[model samples]
Target chain A: MTGRTIVITSGKGGVGKTTTTANIGTGLAMRGHQVVVIDTDIGLRNLDVVMGLENRIVYDLVDIIEGKCKMHQGMIRDKNKLELFLIPAAQTRDKNCINPEQMKELCAKLEREFDYVLIDCPAGIEQGFKNAIAAAQEAILVTTPEVSAIRDADRVIGLLESEGLHRPRLIINRIRPGMVKRGDMMDKDDITELLAIDILGMVPADDRLIIATNQGVPVIYDKRAPSGLAFSRIAARIDGEDIPLMDLGPKNGIMDKVKEIMGINRGAYSNA
Target chain B: MRDLIRWVVTRKENTKNAARNRLQMALMRDRMDLSPDIINALKIDLLAVMSQYLVVGDEFQEFGIRRLDESVFLVSNIRVKELPRANAN
Candidate 1:
């Protein structure tokens, strides 16, 4: 079956590209779609740890491309989701070890079997970034509310357009709602107006995200976590479900909660 | 307590607004790959050329390179107050 290959990228580092890759991959798998996440970060491989499959990576992306092992040998199944898999990058090799042509060939092979091939792109506009986006049919740019990340994202968007990957959707991560309310941080509207891209989803800054990563788990499994719910909604949207954007404003009062319980109000979270 | 006083003093403009304004200006130049110096020089040259044929206003309503769809254009909207003398070379 033909599958969709999407590269989760951000020109600036530490903006949750890897985390978004892991969560969205797991989120899609939890919905019963067969998925594989390939980390193209090379020497700085961390998708394995994020997916909690670090100890199970016998063969890696380099081995699969170098013909040292079969594709299935390099694929590591997730601890919980059987349909989800991860192809970790080679920790010893440099980004120059692989090229765009090889990456394209590998993605072509994987697309024939899986429903989704999520490429975790490295941070930068260098060789690694080129190799990651070479074969992807779609792109999801991750960024924060800060200026530097947005600036870099704008540049990456221009570069992606030049490369013929048009209309890359945006995912704004680590948004602090309180700060947005206090007029201290940029909101989704401000960012979208400037970036001029379709918003895939908005994830709030949740402490649970850190705890989940510390436990070697993606936060999408934490039902009580707001950021986890955000990721699941994003996955649903990616799966062709028309989930409306969540209202990420401040929490409502007790009276509003009562109204929500009575079905008179849909509450602040799902007001569309 | 100190934050309250500062908030009251700077009530007209917040840091977020400052960021938005700065980002917009930066992106305008960045999207066209034009530096501030180049934009300033172009503005002066265009006004100078227009003044030879028409009584052009010193201030331009809009002047910059903007992207529309797949095409990029050097858009300029200068106010022409009046036309020059017909016999003037």
Candidate 2:
């Protein structure tokens, strides 16, 4: 089947690009679609560790590109039983080890076999960034609700537009509802206005995400986690569903108590 | 005393408007890359020449000169009631 190549990118580091790629890949695979995630960060590879497939890498992207190994030999299957796979980057090689043409050729080959090919782009607006975007058919920009992150996201959006990638959707990560309610941090609305782009999803700052990542398990498998549900909804949206965004604030009254009584968690009740 | 109070308030408003107008005109001229000093000198020279032709009262109200782009404009808000009409002869 023909596949869509979606690149998960953010200009600022530590804003959850790797986490997003892992979760979205897991969510899409859980929906029974064949998904392959490629880590484009040549030197500083972390997607393998995040996906818990670090020990399984015999050959990497550089090996496949350098004709040392077959493309299928470099692809590592997920520990779970879904049709998910990952092509880990070579930790020893630098960004110059592969170029955009090589990446585009690799993705074009993978697209024919998988339903979704998600690329985990490296931070910065350098050569690594250009290589990642060159092969992407769709782009998802991840950003935190901070001024610096938003500014960098805007700059990234400008660069993407210059490359003829228009109207890239945004994903607001690490939003703390408490801080937003206290007016200490900018909310999603503020970020959306400043960035002026469509929002694919909003992932809350859930502590369980850290625990799952540390345990080499994606949070999307933890159905009880808010961030997990958010990722699932994002995957569903990508599958062409019009699912409404989940309200990630803490519960505060009879409605929450009713949800507690009914055993309803995660987007349990509607405000309207 | 009431008339004096009204005059004071109105005079303050007029001064504020004049200041705002001058600032706007100066900013426009600056953005258009014109020399303000040259424009001011030209306005003074034009006023002097106009005064020799007729009694030019209230220099601030009688005329205003501003530079717009590469051109200059002269605006006059004179009291026509005080001046003799062309058919007065």
Candidate 3:
């Protein structure tokens, strides 16, 4: 099958790029698609731990690329999902170990096998980031509502465009609605206006996301988690499904409950 | 009562507005690959060139670099009163 390779990237660190990669990879797998997530972060690999497949990684991406092991041997099956797999990065190797040509060739091979190949890009605009994006046909840029993250994201967008990867979809993660309402944090409009990219999804700041990461289980499995629900919607959109974006405003009033029950709560219940 | 007292006592503007303003300026500079001073100089030079053909007004309705889709444009909306006289032989 000719699968699509998409790189999940955020130019800044700790903006949920790895977590987004894990969740979206799992979300696609849950939809019965054969998916493989490759962590191109090299020495700073964390996608395996986030996916809870760290123990299952007997062979890694470097091993397969170096001809030390077969492709299937390097792929580790998920603990719970049958269709999902992961190719963990080499813990001891640096980004200089692999080049863009190798990554392009590797992704071409992976695309022939899986239905979706998701690459978790490294944090900077260095060799690791270039290698991560070299193989992908599309990109999903992750950023927070903060100024620094947005600035870095804009720079990455320019770099991606210069490399012929245009119109990268955006995912704004870890947004705090209270802070936004208080005029302390940037809102979706403010960011979208600056970035000028189509928004793939917006994940609210959820405590359960951190807990799920700590437990080595993706937050997408948590039905009650808002961030989980957002990722699921993003996955559906990526899988060619038309789903409305979720509204993450305050839900404390009885009027909102009544409107939600009547199926008219300002598009908040559209996906629900 | 505490909220009201603090609201009256504090003169702080919303920090998000400040962030939005700064980001707008920064992104404009980045997309054009030029500093604000250079952009200002370029704008003046462009206006001077345009005034050679037409009677350009002193004020501009809109004049700035704008990004739309995949392109960055040095967009301007200057008031043109009339065209200059043509040379007669």
Candidate 4:
């Protein structure tokens, strides 16, 4: 019943876990909820950088957990979203610097004060994974359509369930519509069928995402970007909204369309 | 014409489908606290045991993927065959 704590994680690196966390955190805040995004990637902090609050992090999560500073003192509020805040990780500390119990306690404490606590988990299922998942009541798994990413995701989902974190929703990132349409890449349907999990959203490979990350700004603020729209829908879904998944279905190419008009239209590739 | 229809229905090997099937098997094995080779061995053992119980001159089909321990893991089914008893006794 307390504020929901959801850990955003991907067993594979560079699958956009941090980006999803930042965007979803910002999206929730944009809807007027008090949200706190925590960087649990310890030693390799990036949530702060992605959120553009790196310059304002006076104290980090390790400091708060270690009692070196008050919890509130370590939280850096987003300059753009007054309702959204960030608890940056300590780049100087290792995963051992804070244990799972400490992180769980932190979540318990934050639950009383915020609407959502989003933890940006470190890649790989190790001590850092244990620490990041320790406090989460729910989990959001991020992965790409690639074989390596999905393989790691399957492993991570197994790991999550073994830890009693069951039914974590999935986010398929960096999907290329063109590739999927041409059957050259993994489609969302295939990925969902493989993982056998509820897919929260799918973000198309968008150049704007890279730009947003470089500028420490989330694409959700742009509203026009496909990835931004996807994140917004995901945030809404998390909020108990029953919005239908977006239609990124494959489209018929010009040649295919032209063939259909002709009498010689190959009925073979029509369904495809 | 028949070949064209077959080709249409039988979509080419897509990168996505390949990834999906691989992931599905991997996750199932993983959640079961086992590996691919282990599950395959289990399936083989299962067939052997099933054959032991089959009547003479009888046949059976192999089981498909089955859920084990709720969501913990899935037992990979290889093939259903005649009860072992039919062939043995």
Compared with the true structure, model 4 gives a TM-score of: 0.78
lDDT of 4 by residue, A30-95 (tens): 999999999998899999889988888789999999899999999998989999999998998899
lDDT of 3 by residue, B1-89 (tens): 99988886662678898788788877877777876788778778878988878888876778777666445676888888986667632
* Tens digit of per-residue lDDT, candidate 1, span A1-272: 99999999999999999999999999999999999999999999999998888899899999999999999999998999999999999999999999999999999999999999999999999999999999999999999999999999999999999989999999999987768888888988999999999999999887888999999999999876778889999999999999888668656688767865775432334422
Candidate achieving higher DockQ, 1 or 3:
1
lDDT for A269 in candidate 2 is: 25
True-contact fraction in model 1 equals 0.75
Show pairs that collide, candidate 3.
none
Best by TM-score: 1
lDDT of 1 by residue, B5-76 (tens): 988889756789878777886787788777788889889998898887789899899986766653457888
Clashing pairs in 1: none
Q: Select the stronger candidate by DockQ from 1 and 4.
A: 1
Which runs in model 1 stand beyond 4 Å of their true positions?
A254-272, B1-8, B35-85
Worst 10 residues of 1 chain A by lDDT: A263-272
**All DockQ scores:** 0.67, 0.03, 0.61, 0.48
User: For each of the candidates, what fraction of the native contacts does it recover?
Assistant: 0.75, 0.00, 0.75, 0.82
lDDT of 3: 0.88
**iRMS, all models:** 0.5, 15.1, 0.6, 1.8
Q: How far out, in Å, is residue B62 in model 1?
A: 16
Residue B83 shift from truth in candidate 4, angstroms: 14
lDDT of prediction 1? 0.90
